[model samples]
Target: MSLSLKRFAVLLLALTPALIAARTEPAATLAPEANQAVTARMVYGLLSDSRYAYAPRQLDAALEEDILRRYIEALDREKLFFVASDIARFEGYAGKLAEAIKGAGLEPAYDIFNVYVQRVGERVAFARGLLDAGFDFTQDDEWRYGREEAPWAADTAELDALWTKSVKNDWLRLKLAGRDDEQIRTTLDKRYANLERRVRELRSDDAFQVFMNAYAGALDPHTSYLNPRAADNFMQAMSLSLEGIGAVLQRQEEYVVIREIVPGGPAGRSGQLQVGDRIAAVGQGRNGAMTDVVGWRIDEVVQLIRGRKGTDVRIEYLPADAGVDAPPRQVVITRDRVRMEEQAAKSKVLEIEDRRIGVIELPTFYLDFEGRRTNAADYASATRDVARILEQFKADGVDGVVMDLRSNGGGSLNEAIELTGLFIEQGPVVQVRDASKRTAVHGDSSGAVAWEGPLAVLVNRASASASEIFAAAIQDYGRGLVIGEQTFGKGTVQTLVDLDRFARNENQRFGQLKVTVQEFFRISGGSTQHRGVVPDISFPVTLDASEYGESTYDNALPYTEIQAVPYQRLGDFSALLPELDARHRARAAEDLEFRWFSEDVAKFRAERARKTVSLNEAERRADRARDEAQREQRQAERRAAGLALDEGAFDDDGLQADERNVVQDVARQKAAEDRPDPLLRESAAILVDAVDLLAADEGRLAARVLRPGRTSTVWAGGADR
Candidate 1:
């Protein structure tokens, strides 16, 4: 029997809840709306359909068990709430979730959430009580902070013991930060209260989205469900013009953490805000009192941070890994639209050993989708801007060009092909494989070459999806040298399906689902799925490939190969690679900036590898003191080297020394904009090496520059000659 049909049959035969229920209904039931039921049905129907990239796995008892486990994990990722007894009680419904969803019965999911909320309330109350009692800093007891892989507590007594240690840790952090008893109590009371309030505020839709996403995520990490409000937020994010501080926020425990800073956005250019920083409070204008946001909903916090364009929004944040009692720092950002100028392709000329090399930093493969559909002539795109940059480079008589795609998370797929077309005359860029195994080749038909000169593409671990496509095409065609670390290996394409479209009623509002529909492969027959494009020349990076790429995701599609598409190759770069690598290595070893970067990366990796933190108050204080001393020493070194120190270089308080110093702000921005990027500089040097190598090999050099009317010098799929 078909999996869907069997699933339906199982649901019909197993509608009884007697096996799991101790009561007739949950203590607090926030029932799903009728529209939500319809939405759930539609979502399941779509996933089971042939359009999804992966084949539909049978939603039988075993799959249902997996979904239930995933849902629980999503709700309490760190095993902070819900004891072993709670988990055991929920397991009765593990194999029955498929049946429940089949009949649109969402009470089980809501019941679990209701219990989670109650648990959170109880824990927060206990934490508040402990805060009042204070902690003994001299105690030698340790706290295992990393609990994601740990088991749940056995009972309330066990949970109480855990909460005691957790609360004590928080107290110790504040005590070390030099807070007196009353001050620590005040801060922690508000934090716990916010947590309780946020948990109590969870609506039916929030629970539903969380549970449904668990189901979708089990199939693929990239596939997700977004509720109506979240759907709107997603669209706004894609538009890249939100009137906010321009940082994506997520709730992490009691804090709203900065997930990503939108490029070209206020926070992106600020040089103060960073990913993983916790937003503790937000205020309006220059003089508004900051309101603490700990334990607040992400959307509510976002509303507080967002403002009208050009208006100032003040933010107070705790640096990532900064102890709970670490003084919060504040920054004032003038909210503005995240326009193309911030994310657009930017050009700079670098003089490498008397040869002028042009560098274009492409932050993302962005395109104005709405404008293009409306046929707006002024529409902006990465390819168009890059073409202009190449023209300017030609006019300036540059020897070579470096396309920097470092830290580029990728965007429009069409732009990737278009950008690749600017380097090669005409060829296939990537191939798309759908659910049914049918493959369609996407190629660049534009015959015009933008810059037929020496080209090198620089990428890093964050460079993903569309970035991978462009880099792969360049390497495949021998059109350019791919440099830096391996790409992020996200080769799948997702299509957002609005649930409202499939609803029966016109007035009914349903959420959206971002479903993975296709996987991309390089024209050379290799899939960039879990094995991102390997660089021809590698650079050292601190980020572990296993921890950061598509491989990190459970059930990610494996890498494979297909028949190679026919296309012309530019020239052989094999002989040139050795000379290039040797020169680059020697230069990197001798460069002070590179040495500093290497040391910083090593330190970062070492810190990340430490899963357990010293919980002893004295040890932690000593460590913090040592770190502060080192930071001051670094500042002194920078001063000695004649570099200007940041205004907050030595401030213990979170507030900037001069909040309204417009001149200093502008100077800092300019300095950041004009700062020499070590990686980019190295890439340009590598391109110069390529130029010199080609200059010596006249025959191979002629092959690159003297291409005759898109003729094939080498087969696209075959080994390079």
Candidate 2:
């Protein structure tokens, strides 16, 4: 139901049996369909040992089939804002699938088609019902493809089909806005014809996605299979820029749909190109003849439009309207690279009530791989830049700093150690354990301490890998405070092994598996595996906790405790915890709607736990009714709390106000417990308090300041990965 990465990953892997059948039961009930287990030894032997043959490990057909089945089942588990009836229909297809997989002949496909047609009929009926019920699905943000890369070119037809389906889906949401059944049916008829023609011309999403899997799986999973044009676009994405009018386009039937005009780029600068416009024709330069691009492969169409920077490219487009009477418009745009500067790390100083705290939002720890190959600065450059910003903040006398690592996917491992070292005097940053149980402790070999201030590491459901390691180490060493949601529970380390290294011939191509070998552990005792790196201070943000952690993944390793390493505490901040708790409670009480939402979400969970799918039409209708009733009950409760009774009300945009409230709440809590945070207000306050305590105890700070390591020179024997 939720689109958490953990849930989607399970869906992507498709290795869980229950996922294949739209069931949530344990896999033991299904036949023992697992492939031979992928072991650390097998992976290692393939990489390091020479005894093994240079071949990808082979699996039996049954196992491969099981993998696909499980993968599909897993995808269905996320609920993904799919219409409940569509979901029911999808499950209904599973029966036909089971029969088809077990049996043979056109009779199976014919029977499946009968069920499929009925499902389509039901879809049309439900679309009308939603219209009658006053729902507006199209406007729902969930309809937008969330944060994934643009779909490649082979998927043009699929994209078109989705656009067509989305039109109907969106109409259903709109229909819920007090429309009569007559009007609804009329709208549905138009949508049905559009969808029918589009669907017939395009491949089914299931088949298309399956083909994608095979194609991508053939290469390295990271190296995707894009159509010739999507391939060009993919190259641009890697370079962090793109040319050709700077508009993200998609193929919708005969139309090349404009998804978004890149902000500040050519199309954006043109002040004419708009999102949701379709290019029916294109012309190069100012005087070239207009070439009809309708039905052309998206790439061929793009070539017709692309030209030198600052050169004009004309696009003949129709505005995105399902209505037939809309006229086409011509717009001219120049070509330029769209720079993604927004994704770069940004710094700000927050005046949290009385406390002044510095916040560094690290979106992603990115390293320019190409730049690094050319011996240009990499993550080190970014870190150095951030350090300069921190130094400036220090000069401004901010109390503490919050390194906002939320949603930060990992980058260079080298940077992780270096960043950790920046805050502490030379010591082991993290202890990495390998398959042989050999412990390798990576230390801050750099003797300099760039920042010695009180630190607060902020993370959430999306914080992962290097983020987890750094947070865990800081918590373990008592160097900083970890605030906000738990870090993503990905404790395993992956080493990219070139599959070609073991390939038997020039054409010996095999996909690489990002095999997990070593696991990470806190210096204290715990491994951030299934349990993840839990914050010392916990705050609730999202309702779908079960949807986002290592526990949600079937193949994830379990958490365990390790022997604690002896490490010095940075300073004592534990005394402030009680006051911090009190302040948080006081702030949470003022947010009445947030409180009500929490209660309603709990009820939704209970409802979800009680739901089951069946094939009978009457039973399915009853289930739909139950779901609608539950939704109505939730709405009534929200209305009682004085919240608006809008259908698509609980959106991220609406949630921003609540997020601000929560931020304010946190600010208050931090202020109550500590001084103004440049790194961590609570930590700084604790530092101030410690300064007083140490002064009273007679100059302990001078005695505890760590000295440099015994030796600083590098050895001739080896270099690190």
Candidate 3:
């Protein structure tokens, strides 16, 4: 049977009785607003429309089960709030979700959420009571950190027992950090109170977003429903500009943790804030009392932090690795707009063994959409900046170039095509496959070639979407050698649909949905979907591919291929692979920095593999002590080796610390900024090897044919050089 017919049959078999019961019985008392009802209907209409990638698939029993599971997981990811009994009760509506969505009957979702809220309240009260009873730190015990895979509690008694251990663990952590009983009590009380307050503040819009996203995510990971506030945030992120500190924040348990520091933002410029740091409190202006924000909603915290361009916002953050008892440091940042300059491509020259290699580090493939539409001459874009940098490199007589796309999450598909155009003459760059299986080829019409010197593209696991497109194109044509880890597999295209567009009333705010509508493919027939653009040369894998990337998503599209498009084979690097590999291996074996990096990756893997941590106070203390000692020893070794040490490496008493010379501080910062990056240096060395290989007789045919500004004619089989 056809897939759609099979789905329809399954839907009828599973949902017929549920739909009948739903119509006969009164709808559960959710008290959903008129706007929310309109929003739900609009979202369902869009998902079912032919414009979406998954529109061909019906809302069958299988999809209903996925939506049900996704909604439950969204509510209690850690299995801490709801019990197995609650899950069983919700499972009754598992096959009925499709019907509910069609009829705009979101009561089942709201009902499940209400139960989760009630459970959270109960758990909070139980946890608060446990704080008064002092924990026995001497007891030998362990606490599982991430309990997402663990089964839910069987009963209230079991849940209380779990909370007892959790509370004890928290107390032990603080106590090990040298916190007194009174201080520990105060902190725990405040944390619990804040959590309760935040939960209470959850609005209907928030619940709608969570539930709708659960439904959308059943189709694809990238598909999501954003509330009004979240929609605004999404728009700001896409524009690469926002009036705030420019740091990505995520809520972890009760703490707001800094996920990334946007380059050129106030927080990025401060040089004090770091990823994984927890924000404890926020203060307005300079003298406003710090408002504890430990359990505040991420959006609320963001609103509190953002202000007028010139206003000051002070943040109290605890360093990632700092002890619980360690006092939080206050950082006052004058808020400003995060501009294009911050996210633009930057270039530098690296002199490696008499080879002057120009390196362009592209943070993101950003473009000033407004400027482009206005036909502004100074329109900022990755392609424009990169072209200018290439011109500079050519004028300076650089031998080779490296395009560093490491940690670039990707942006602007147009920029990716334009950037790729700077290397290859007019040809098919990427192919787009839509919902109906109709394929469209997107080629660069401009035949302009920028600096086509011996090139290398540096990528890591974080390099995704447009980054994958560019890297795949370059590698497909054999124009450049891809280095580092594989790119993040995110080949699907998303189009944001404003829910307000479908609304009948102008004042109604229905938010938006970022729906996945298309998938991209390389000219070489391979799809950079679940399997990303693999580097020609692989590095020591820092991130486990199984735990990260598109492959990690259960519903991610499978890897596929199509007939190869006709294009010129620029050069054959296959002959030089063995020699280059041997050279890199030899150098890596002797490189201290490489050894250190490999060891770090190994340590991280080991740590991630462990499911539980010792809750026993003595064992925990011993672990912390060993970690600290190793860190200090490493710092000492680096200092002894004449390498620059981190500013935090040295310990200093507050006494006379302020007497330090400003000039000396500035010099130290400059030296640290100029410190050599071991990975980039290695990549440059590899490029140098490529240059040498190209100079050899065996590679002469390929090298002579693949010259800068040379255009090849398309032959019957392929392009002829």
On TM-score, the candidate that comes out on top is 3
Q: For model 3, what is the alpha-carbon lDDT of residue 597?
A: 70
- Error (Å) of candidate 3 at residue 83 is 0.4
Candidate 3 regions exceeding 4 Å error are 1-31, 242-341, 368-371, 374-380, 395-397, 502-508, 647-677, 696-721
Weakest 10 consecutive residues of candidate 1 by summed lDDT: 1-10
- Misplaced by over 4 Å in model 1 are 1-29, 139-142, 168-181, 242-358, 392-399, 504-508, 628-676, 696-721
Candidate lDDT values, in order: 0.74, 0.50, 0.75
Worst 10-residue lDDT window, candidate 2 = 712-721
Candidate with the larger lDDT of 2 and 3: 3
Q: Looking at model 3, which ten-residue stretch has the lowest summed lDDT?
A: 1-10
lDDT digits (tens) for residues 451-543 of candidate 3 = 656788999999999999999998888778899998789988887787776565565398988888988999988899988989988788877
Clashing pairs for predicted structure model 1, backbone only:
328-654, 329-654
lDDT of 1 at 617: 77
